[model samples]
Target chain A: MASVLPRTVQGPPVPLRWPPEDNRIPREIFTDPDLFRWEMDAVFTGPVWVLVGHEAEIPQPGDYKTLSVGAVPVIVVRGADGQVRVLVNACAHRGARVVEGPRGNVLKGGFRCIYHMWTYAPDGSLLGVSLPDDFPVEFRKEDYGLPRARVALYKGLIFASFHEQTPPLEEYLAELTQGMDRVLGDGRLRYLGSIKVIFRTNWKLYVENIYDGYHVTALHTGFQVVRLRSHGGQRLVPNYERNGHLWGQSRSTRREELQPVLRDMSLFDVRTKPTTDHNMMVVFPSGVVTDYFDTIQLRYVLPLAVDQTLIEFTFFARADDPEDVVRHRVRQGPAVLGPAGAITLEDAAALERVQQSSVARGDNVILKGTPKRFPPYRHVDEAPIRHFYQAYRRLIGVPVEEGTP
Target chain B: MNNADDLSVREQAARELLARYVRVVDDPDRVEEWPDLFADQAEYRVVTRENLEAGLPISVVCDDTKDRIMDRVTVIREFWGAGGRLEDRHYNQVRPRHVVGPVWTEPQEDGTVRVVANFVVWGTPTTDPAPRLLALGEYRDVVEFTARGPRFRSKWVVLDTPVLQDVFVYPL
Candidate 1:
């Protein structure tokens, strides 16, 4: 339970109590600078795992990619010792980012800070200081190693946590990783590519949209028209399993109609069914792995500000996938996954409007088989949203009251 | 034994044909000409320079088949127009997707012409008075002489920038 903070005697900005009992979220959560800082401290940089990249992305020893966990810049690198490490990108001396661009290979002497020529090993150990001989007598070289977060991996997707008390990735994911297993069957994911874009909305808003199953048909009507008309709905099932994890299994029927010259032959694994197997799994905080109609991918999100979020729709082709099949999968992934993706394109418009309109006084109600009333959920049910809000409330240190936003 | 007049006539004809094609592709009012610009089995892909250089398969806009290109038109008219977010662009309500200037054309050998053009697709939201550049990319094209005169054998829109402001509801 979240400990209640003092009310009415506030000098600082926290959550408000106006209408206090409704699931109608206060607009401040999406726009306030104070709330963003608090969430960075209490939720993102706190006891939570941030999904960054995959082991294959940095297959070489010196290969590295820069990413962000919350607002903290991170460098996911494979060290010379064959270990994947997540080092803070800030230079130990001047706080300048170590890894400059998105990613590159620095095999020889770790990362070198262009600002002051402070070099660090691939494993984040301090290596050289150009003006080292003139520092304080008590300045020890060993104490200046790059700060690192705890790195972990499930299958091939890499994740890291800032806090030491954060539970292991297995425990943090709970039984949710079981669903992830199906998506990453055998875990031999070949890096296809990624389309990176920033959403002009809060990162939390984008994460919540992942679990908002209700918006599938209404918001993305064109896609729904295609899917429902093409594939006879094989019953959309939502897995609101505990721990803020969500899994959805829905089969598409339009396989034969839209079959290209090279179709998806379930090149992934024997466990993956062709048209009948469609699943989307969202890990807590901001990682989404979706296996839609034989095209598998992950959506990694990073928060930049209260009203901005950077996201990457990284599509993959299995290592053993046939050449033509890989081409087909590539065509399929971006068609419906990223900024220029299928239904996602329309979704961006609606989501931006939601953020833009959150400045006014309003309370949005969640009902109609929402999480508060599950057990008899339908394809059109909003139950997953309730599950998200419950998890969000707990994570954001907001008191959990039934039927409250 | 090469005649300057013959070469001048050929170059003028090629440039004129390319100029006509650019007008049809660039004008929002003449977007209906998109279908006629492609051959029966043509490929038009709007991709990033990075993907193109790497020989990657994915694209921002991939319309390999003639049907997919037609689907883009039908989908835009039927789906995007019916009453969704695109309607919210109050600044220029007629059609938000259009190409800008700098349509450069170069004549190539064997009845082919290489073409290049830069464009910015804007999404003028009703909330803001100014129109936002949704995507800025150059059209890398290879036009050839087909049965139906000059047509787009393939057009690859190589977007210089990585970010596309919001949605790509229309042609790049």
Candidate 2:
């Protein structure tokens, strides 16, 4: 909550190229408190859609979970009408956070603000304010109902938009779902479990890292184990791209991606047949969805500060999967992607190292091995990074010259 | 030894083994000795209390066998070998009580004793001001009664705090 700043306090004009070229990002943007403020204004609050929670998480009616989009608290609840509602968690009366902790089922009288006892229904309707007879004449109870953001649900995943005018979630993700990356398989996703960790790095760095195909074979330690057993001829290509959404495809079962302890041959055999492939998707701003091997993980990134990022990783098992498959997901999900994932741990260390060095005056280069305007799907191309930077530049408040991206 | 004395000896041995377990885990220089502390088929995990209560199948460190534990040690040696995560030391001091309801040892005919103890481990990272609480939880340990000494058949680390900072490269 401390990360969100007032809109009035302005900072110096950013001293750099308006639209950075050659896949270069000004290092100041990584460390500048002012740019972070503008990011809150333009990127987060301006037409950006945030993925709040999946319906499976708040299954029962009256169940609610607390989340935030750039420090603005939000409550994702299931109403008695059986529709999931996304409401601002701040109390309308005194601005106190109405929901406590991460999640819970609503008690009697809906949710009561502990600070002033103002109550609200599950549908975000105002129930009552404390000592209503003593209120001023102009104050109407109906006028202060819990303010809600525009909400949309696609395949059980809930998305909320804070902007006054943003496209629907489906329209926003139009091009990508047609090809390359598509998951949430047949709309029967089982809610497995969750874990969160704070990285000592900028939030953008982690978001870009998600669609990264270049670094997988090099950085993640577990990949080496799988590669050793996998058929050595596998290749990765930019499988799909559109509207700030990008994904890569490669064989999910190259050598049998085996965990030494829990042997699930299916994970290794997923892509061996022509039927399946691994997919990584990044919905602009900071919603990452991945489906590879035996697990489906949703990466929710929260920008806490210029130098700190909070990442919540939630894994899901297929609803139709047997107990063995679910157990396999529990064992193997973290092995590849969570806080304790083999490659994820290394990524955290490398990101923090960059955070320490990023404060200096410099250009963070992304044009490592690509010459194409949109880059390619090769293991070392900067295409995904370039794709993200374009969306970021267009959304940010600064003016850009003609033909920037 | 008689019944009372035999029980005392077993408890004393269990206590010493538990201390040695912590000492081995805390020493970064002696990482090779970690896998030896457990039996080959040992079950090890570092899980959140909430996940445990909700029956959620997720963990910070979930290894069903000692081979996976050894793999972690191998990663520290090769993957994060030179300069991986922040340099740190662990201070694990087990607070044990004499005969208690939840902690009574059950000796098995298969040469194993099930012992449960409580522990609080502190971490002193190079960047932190002082030692801070890393994890505080109960250890549901299965100690084998071998002639060579007590070794863990399984050790479940159920942490009360779910949220953790950065990476959990090292074991809890």
Candidate 3:
């Protein structure tokens, strides 16, 4: 018999009280500041792919959007050559931030650092610096260009990684691509807009909440009031033992069958897709892609601190959509999915309460559909959350027991 | 009454309508009174300054018609379990308070008056100790002197900051 090789990760010992049963997660991890900082290094900057933006967001050359990758602020800009580059927002000269607003086109003048007027091209190559003649003997503009992350595109979705050893985008996504394709269609999407909100909870709670299907009908009373239930579907964890990405697929009740709760029932209508089947997927660490009803949304989870997370809900429409269809999407997208949406504020309420009580010190147990400790759970199961933590444990240097998977 | 006094009276009514709006939304018990402040065919939308300036059509809340405006109350009171239903109490009970200042009323070429004011809202959760700043924005409102009273023709809440600190249960 051949022996399995043991993987090792290095970090400071977390104040975690993990139990023998893999389902019980200690509350300390949510509140520990040291662990949060360590995660920025071990999990984010470690070998992992983080979704930054979609190609439709910056379709034109010199168009750019700014966001943070883990703790590092980055600019996701489309170069004049039609390639997307995730450059660090800081200037090479004194490290002053280059980009100011949320998004804009730099085609006119490129990114200029206001501190000393050091400027760079759309592709992040240093174009000029003020008073460079009085510099050192080895002064080279090529060497002083803003640092950037390795970028990969799966369809139109853009993913960025700081680590050199991160796997290829296809291998990283695994079987989740099928679900993404089902939602993305031909990948020709039009960017409508985005609503950025701060959730008063850890980033893990926000991501895990998406994996937890058990709370849907319970916490969100709107779902219950509409009498909408999943017809038939299952929860899938691709590469469960390794990455533990969640693909929650389900076919929902038709709009005609739903109860008339709202005066405008258009919020529940699904006109774009052929069937009522929808996907809510978490791409490993912190990328949420879902096509709930006719609304297509992508959530970027940015951890601001141990207790706070910034979630930008970016909505989209198919490039070939008609005017009425676009209007329906605009009216329905934020009404149901955005921060203050009818069904969405309940999550913020629930998650904030959870973060409040995490200081009480105990294990938050997972009971719903944890009979055998693996994937292939029901559509209304919370068991896939365990796999999420398992991948998290591997990255954070916590050892899994022998034959755990 | 003199022409100057009549003009001042009309402005007072417009300002009073604005005052009544802040009073209704700030009280948790008076959420039902919110939609009534609008005209029969009014539009209400809450959009971030970034998206608004960029000409993005998406909004955090887009109640463009009277039916949708009335439905916002239904969503808060009945759907969200905020109507004192203990069995299905999912949403947190927060006391909303709004601060309005530097009001401006511009009479358009037509009879409608445009009211602009800088406002900030604070939410104090029933369970938590600290009060959270929900949103700070400028309200670009159009007030029509209807037969009933000065009702809002349209109210656009333009947020000063793009990042909302937390989800707001009531209208801002």
Candidate 4:
């Protein structure tokens, strides 16, 4: 069944270009079923380590949580010996999922299957089968243990990779590690829980939407009412890099700089004093960690298909924080990123609208952020997205073809 | 005021207070009335069933006093934060299951009347015309009757739903 690629076809023979330097992303990337399949193989199961969760999520031994790795469901558990393990949730025999709950502790021992009473150790080693006499000579319980996935941790953040060739998690994180470290800090963290929402648009749209700084002022004007009114309007100055990573800083005129427009400022006392260095970081494929004053937000994007994505928003605070401070941080943080969050709610609506609009348009969507006159700017521009497409082209092995509106 | 029946009446009043609290939240415009239903010293919390069962000290929403409740309402309505049109209705079926101590004539002076009830809040989103089920959760409240009427001294909302649909901004 895996070999059946949907709608696979060779485009009309055209001039072949190596590492094509086109800034525009083909619209098919969003809606093509075949491309989606290829992405699951090339990106998700490829050499990139995907952030599974934070260590704070399962702090105690025997504690476990279930999540998906691409299309595959995985269970992350902390054994009694104080080691974290990621195991494929599927049962070794009938392939049924072992744990269904989001999180819980396995009392007395390891996970036991309800179907046949197949018990496994907390670390995913096969413990004992219900019956031994019925098994064939070659049917060894040890060989039937739960399969484990490669797991790695940086600071307290946990990540997993299916491909053995993936670079070390630290090297893959690259420059993004600095920002992530700052967010985690030296303090221990507790699982503040998670909010999961499914968006109708393709997952990449969600990733790009968060990474693109150009849309904030116009798209999120309603929620930014206080920020704009206080700062006398702000613009995002984006800094893009080569490895499909981008960070942006929001610059706004201070109260003293624009005293005339800042009259009756007490009306918007809710606005925290503006900081010059409001940073937004995007780690390609998935994972976006943003730092606002007094609060930090982690948005993990899991793509289910070309048109479906599961977005989980998890909030964190210092483990030893005062009750009041933790509560304050949770409240303020959700105001920006949660389901009722100002920016995300609008983005959700926009994503739905874009999905509807794209159905009527042609096969290509132009990324205007990329210039056409000069060769697509290499370092400073939206070339990161272009670079991503270049990587996409290599993995999918798709020949570049041109089309007219 | 010194009659023996005053004790039963006060107990009934405590139950009535919780009922009124549910009604206020159901009424969209009257949601602002929640703060007044509590005493000057009140505690409110919104937490998940897991945390509550595990005896974990955490809540998605926690307010210490009427002032704090008022501040939350003010921020939700006027603050330049996240915004979406939502409709939440709380249905609390309060049953005067038991009375802890000897009923007292003056309800505020003696802490005898204790009322416990089970509640369910149905939250629906209005932004989308379809109006899907956004959240369903239970509420546990402890009420105390005062001379004026009944006031909620403490309320805890425990949600059974495992995955929170989105950020819970309004009281459930």
Candidate 5:
């Protein structure tokens, strides 16, 4: 059956112009299936810490959530011992998916795979298997337990890495933690719920769109209607030499000062902060954290295919927030950032058009804040996108020009 | 009329309201009429089946009040540049076609009607030839008769597809 199948193509679809210019990106990266497959191996599974979920999501014992690390499905579960484990969802017996749902609690009987009634504990330890006498004598249940990634926690944010060479969470995060700390605010959050939407664009295009600051007022007309301009801020590429994580800090016009577009002005009201300062961050590859207005949102980007991506916009509020405040956060979070959000729907419209046109085959050049090809770019500049591709090319083993920055 | 006959008459009125709603939403030019379908005090929300079953309060779109519901119309036309507004046309112009059927209506004791129906919306963007499936959901609604006509007291769109395939420009 395999011999009759068409030969698989390796490497990029089109020959990459070697040692790419800092501001120019090859359009082929967004449309190539072969390159996307290679990225799953080199970038996602390689020495990289991917943000899976926050501790607040699965707070109770035996509470579990299913997410993917690149293309590999894994379960982020809280054990009875109060430990959060990231375990592969596939069963060891016949390679069946142990868990099926997005989230649930398994405190009662643990994860019992209906495929063969193989039961595993909350900690992913194999408890029992149906009719085990038929198995080989050398088969040890201990060795057959689900494979788990090296887990790390930073202010209740859970990160998992399959590669042993992945750096410490703090080191990988670096200066990005300052912005995260400002947004997290002591790291005690209550999970409200998440709205997942599929963006018709490459995963990189979706992630890099956050790093871009130039598109705020141009593409999103909602910003223009309210006359909200960045008062003062800078787009920071923390660990630009290695990680190229984006930490875009900005203070926009206050709600009262903005043009009254909506009757319910609570959408743009920033009551929690003394100023209208907010933080928007991308944790290297696929995690998006933002504190825009009173909304605390974390977006997990999962690539479905070369031109398709799944973005789960998870919202949160302070655990100690009053009832009204929690309600405010809940109402404000998705309305501004989710799929039907006032400012968010435009990005989907724009990125999908870009994805559809990438087959035209040309270099998409970065012009904003690219004169010097280095840091100190304006808050409204899209220069940080260059560093993003730099880090991406490094992981994909594409030779970037020396001193490109 | 007898009890059975009266109930059927109420259900028929509720069914007409549902049919009118799909027609109004399907036409992009008639978006302003969307809010008029609801009562003066109403709640409109779009939530996923997974989240709703888990007892989560968050939703994709939570217009919990009539004011908020009206505000959505403003956001769609003015902010999203749908109604020939003087702003950058953000959303691509798409013709929304709702395939709704197998509706059930029950007359309530409080003089309101409980309505339920399964619906799937197909979006044909002006730019693309292919029409995409925008949403697949069940509408759990409540209707109240007023001096003008029957209006929706509550409209809850429960999505069967947990992962939305695309961003909807208008209401489902």
Candidate 6:
């Protein structure tokens, strides 16, 4: 069992307390304008580093992709010098997005703005000007280059933080790093492809939903029909940590469980032995890495507002995988998860419904998974939510024991 | 003059094939009719807009062989999956470009047509009850002429929509 920190700290070890063991999460967190403002400053732009993407997504030199860190749009580009850099997507002049496309190669060693042709190098250094004589001598090209956010990479996952005072990426990840490394298989990954879906729910809701095994049987009834079940009973083996990360392990059910329901359950019976434990890891704030069978799925949850989130699911294959296997993975990719995926679609629908119902009720939704029977179980069982809210309360400078109205 | 007449006929056939494909997928009453558009050895895929625009060799939804397509359709149509409640419609526009390939002298025995056309598909959903646009993309097709006219040998949905609205259930 894990240990609980206090709600308030004086000097170094801040004691954090979990909220009251009630199912209801305050409705204010979802709809309040002030809370959203606080989160943008304290959570998204705070000490935690948000995972923008895997390094494999932009592999070659000049390759670039756009990502959103909270509301700030950023461009992750691989330069000609073979270094990956993250820069604010906004132009230095009028705040226009320098790169409009999702992912591409700049080809000319730098990116040129479409609006005014203001060019910049891959490392956010100013390259050249469209018209040199127009600006004054004081307008230094060095000063006009793209602005960069603090960037770090763990295994191949790249993370960026807007705040300079944020903790080091490794220190911030803590125990969550191990689970991320496991998903990467020690940095052996290739870009398969991705499916980006926009959902009408708070980003936190999506993150919380990832490790909540309790919703699988009830909300994801489609999985049961498709014969996708855990070998180990329905309950998930939860591993909670001090950094607010949770990793759940479940056994893959035998083929027989799926045979009765699915007409073509044999399609997945490709003589491949399941060597690794099926794992689901939720990184603090907004990243979920799930290893389903042999496939590695990474989901980056980006918040648009208190009520909107953009969920990007990227599927990966081993870099040395056979051509047929790669093709097979691609074919099976859309079938299991993502917006086009059978299982993911249900989750998306359920999330939207949950949002709507919660709005109608206008009250705190209760979390029943809180463990109260034994003190030992309290840390591992009910502590994740408590840990999360404690982190939230600390960041937002809210009093934890403030009673509900 | 003979070449012009042949080109016109081929172009008309391509247009007809695309129209039929769209009609089948958009039909609310007969959903299964859409799957019948493919031949026994047909292939289908749905790729991202970014990959399509960049001309990258990656697909978000890929069904290589007829057996694979059958397995996918069977799972969704028969087996209960997560995206069971979605009702979608594909509105496509096709443009035929002349290319030198095997000209069809007669209908093939395997019910396959041999033709190529560039197509664009716009998908809209009825579930949200607000008539929302789901996806927009281009389709590069390889059609075969069967005894019953023309069918798709392969259809790749090269999407151009920035973000997928929700989930894509059926083949495009």
| Clashing pairs counted in every model | 8, 6, 0, 1, 0, 19
Interface RMSD (Å), each candidate?
5.1, 5.0, 1.9, 7.4, 2.0, 5.0
Per-model DockQ against the true two-chain complex: 0.35, 0.38, 0.70, 0.14, 0.66, 0.28
* Model 1: docking quality category: acceptable
Between candidates 2 and 6, the DockQ winner? 2
Off by over 4 Å in 5: A1-15, B1-6, B82-90
Task: Give the C-alpha miss distance for residue A268 in model 2, angstroms.
Answer: 5.4
- Candidate 3, residue A179: the lDDT equals 92
lDDT of 6 by residue, B1-172 (tens): 6855755665567567777776666544444676677777788878876766655445666576776666665555543333454331111111112122222222324533345434433344333444444556556677776666666788877666667765545555
Candidate 2, chain A: TM-score against the reference: 0.88
Which lDDT tens digits does candidate 5 get at residues A1-405? 000111244344445564357788888899889788878866777677899999999999999999898888999999999999898888978889999999999999989898999999988889999998878889899877877878888888999887777889999999999998999989999999999999999999999999899999887778887887899899999888888999999999998899887888899989888899999999988888899999998989999999999999999999999999999998998999999999999899889989999999888888888885666578899999988998898888775767656
Higher-DockQ candidate of 3 and 5: 3
> Cα miss at B8, model 3 (Å)?
3.5
Cα misplacement distance, residue B59 of candidate 4 (Å): 3.4
- Give the Å error, residue B172, model 1: 1.4
Model 6 misplaced regions, further than 4 Å: A1-22, A107-109, A130-140, A233-243, A260-276, A372-387, A402-405, B1-23, B53-57, B78-129, B147-149
**Cα displacement (Å) at residue A333, model 1:** 1.0
- lDDT by residue for model 4 over B23-84, one digit each (tens)? 67666556578788877677776666765675544455556556656665654543323333
lDDT per residue for candidate 1 within A1-405, as digits (tens), equals 111111232222475443454345566678788878777766666667888888867878899988787777889999888888888899888999888777778897679999989899988888988977779999987888888888888898898887767777898787667777878887777887677776888887787776666777776655543444323222122333334666665655454443232222222222335445566777777888888766688888888888888788787878788887787777667765667654576666667777888887476566656445443345455556666666666666664665543
After TM-score superposition, what is the CA distance of residue A81 in candidate 5 from its true location, in Å? 1.4
**Global lDDT scores for all candidate models:** 0.67, 0.68, 0.88, 0.59, 0.87, 0.63
What does the lDDT read for residue A29 in candidate 6? 71
Candidate order by DockQ, decreasing, is 3, 5, 2, 1, 6, 4
TM-score of the second chain in candidate 6: 0.65
lDDT of candidate 4 over A114-142, digit per residue (tens)? 87888888888778878778688898777
TM-score of chain A for each candidate? 0.87, 0.88, 0.96, 0.81, 0.95, 0.84
Q: TM-scores of all models?
A: 0.87, 0.86, 0.96, 0.73, 0.95, 0.80
| Residue A50 lDDT, candidate 2, scale 0-100 | 81
Model 6 whole-model lDDT (C-alpha atoms): 0.63
Pitting candidate 4 against candidate 5, the one with the higher TM-score is: 5
